[model samples]
Target chain A: MYDGIVQDLIDELGRLPGVGPKSAQRIAFHIIQTESFDVDRLATILQTVRERVRFCIICGNIGEEERCAICRDPRRVPTAICVVEEAKDVVAIERTREYRGLYHVLGGALNPMQGIGPDQLRVAQLMTRLQDPTVEEVIIATDPNVEGEATATYLIRSLLPLGVRVSRLASGLPVGGDLEFADEMTLGRAFEGRRTVER
Target chain B: MYDGIVQDLIDELGRLPGVGPKSAQRIAFHIIQTESFDVDRLATILQTVRERVRFCIICGNIGEEERCAICRDPRRVPTAICVVEEAKDVVAIERTREYRGLYHVLGGALNPMQGIGPDQLRVAQLMTRLQDPTVEEVIIATDPNVEGEATATYLIRSLLPLGVRVSRLASGLPVGGDLEFADEMTLGRAFEGRRTVER
Candidate 1:
């Protein structure tokens, strides 16, 4: 519905994860009309990211080098590895300032419908890392969805024989969230995973 | 929360319209991981759009040349012109295929909160265009929101003494919208502008 290059820019932007047609148009217009928007800088960054960024050879996290920053840092605990669905999940976990261990990015979770399975993920790489015998625990931190749960189950099954402790991130009501708004599955999980308090 | 270039890319993407930090991260990751996404093409288009596209000098609509396609067309009625707030609105009106006239883009609406006034818009250029004896009518098709309404009102006051027909697009119930779900203002407008139907 727009002229040549404007429409082309919108079409490319619309292919991103959450951008719709209207949003694409708005962004494209902002780029075209706003003089201080730094079109060259954004375009340069896009080109640079494509040329520079790559997955860490060890954990599959995004980085420029063979290993990501966390994997390269010797201060982090190598004994405990937090396994997650993607590199984004690693960042989410890192934001909490709780986990001091390294990470393993699975690339994606198991989805039978989409034909994604054990072979599609970095499951073999994870297993190879566990062969060191120094790693004591593997914490599965995939999303609390069907595909994530299936992936966790599959990982648990595969890691059991290696004798390392396997654990999953707890499922329950979110912090500061009202119980009334909690879904049935979450409420049920909260009840099932209930812990006793000291008197 | 991320490394150098990756974080830089995310920060840039986050500055776009409707994209928050999380969405920016997702888009950045999509660019980094998806080999088939064609990052070079998107980046190249961004650069090309900035280098090539410019607004039509006559009507203030975006195009590659001195005047936009609509302004250059000879078949469209020269007597009637649709005055809209932006180039995007011209596309919206054209999609309906209901109007067969030229367009005059005002750049933006009269937004007092944002310090936008008549001088900030293309009001003077519109007046200059209307000076031609051949022009007979002006249709104000700005948005239906507060700023758009204010702009329409301002345009009406300015264009009244021009000795040409001036009209605002009808405000009422949307075509496929339910009357019960209509907002109070819209319902009131519907009643105020009610038209008699012939059986």
Candidate 2:
């Protein structure tokens, strides 16, 4: 800590996720020294994000209004709703330019260790969104981790009786990634999900 | 990119040093999602720092007033001033609990290729500070880089005629760092700076 405001800035920066003390120090100095960096714009955006941005009423995804862009998009298929653990996941899926369905953000996956359960999530909201008769399939696009798997399993069990086709995003070897470097579980999953190539 | 404010926040965060697009997204989300995170306070601090913080009139270190905390503190040896390239360097030296002297921040090292020279730095301010009869010794704690070495050489040439004793920070193997993996230059410096054990 150097002085009053400097130390305070470092402390605040350090509180951000993945920003350790050393990183916080570097960032604080960066903000101070980088003459071209617009600190005012960043602060304003932060304030605006807090004030204007909110969860979509229908799907729990982040939005400026009651409905998110995907929810409001007429081009998206209403018959399919992709369920994800967070709003960021929605962005990741969108980046692929493949999925053209509405999204249902669960807010977070079920993590029993962290005292986060289905009740703690937007699971109720997801269920409510599925009640629409136009929905045909629910794609589980949660992370390939224990908590995400548990959440997907719970949702699958719950959605089976709802008379909807439930599906999940496939986990396999990523493109351009080394096959030998892949973990045992990913390799096993790849083998399990093997499909016949069309001639 | 995310919807509206989310994307805006991510963009703003990405402008920060060392924060890549992914890290920016993560930080932006963290700021929006964290329940206890005081966005208001962080914003206030950034604004306050920008408003209140200023370079010291004398030494060019960051200060709320005309003088920095170290400069204001009478306990520090006024006769011995440590020279560094940036305000961050002052904090780094302060952290060691070794140096209890005033500091002169040069703003940046002499980078001739990049067009930074003696005139661009706080060279005149440093020379003025050294003119004080009470001031005896000047310690150069600039980074051990080409630019820093050039700046040090320039300072030494300039200060020698003034009859003030000038010293430089020692270059050697870092404490607790593996010697086997140490670069040749570092190993050579370590050998050159080898100190005899007191009997």
* Best-fitting candidate, scored by lDDT: 1
Residue-level lDDT tens digits of model 1 in A15-116 = 998898878988999999999999889989999998999899999999988899999999999998988888987776666566788899999989989999
> Interface RMSD of the predictions, in order shown?
0.7, 1.0
Docking quality (DockQ) for each candidate:
0.76, 0.68
Q: Which stretches of candidate 1 lie over 4 Å from their true place?
A: A173-199, B173-199
Error of 1 at B75 (Å): 1.1
Q: Candidate 2 lDDT, tens digit per residue, A1-199?
A: 5779988999999999888877888788888877787778878888888898888899988889898888888988999888888888777666656667888988888998899998999989888877889998887767766777788789988887888888775567554432323455664464345332211
Q: B129 in model 1: Cα distance from truth in Å?
A: 0.4
Q: List the residue pairs that clash in candidate 1.
A: none
Please write out the lDDT profile of model 1 over residues B1-199, one tens digit for every residue: 8889999999999999889877898899999999999988999999999999999988999998899889898989999888888888787667656677899999998988899999999999999999998898887777667777788778888887777888766666464432223454664454345332211
Cα lDDT of model 2 by residue, B1-199, tens digit: 6777788888888877778887898888888888777888899898888878889998999978888888888899988888888887777666555667788999998998999999999999999988898888787766666777778788888987888877766566454432223454654454344332211
lDDT of model number 2: 0.78
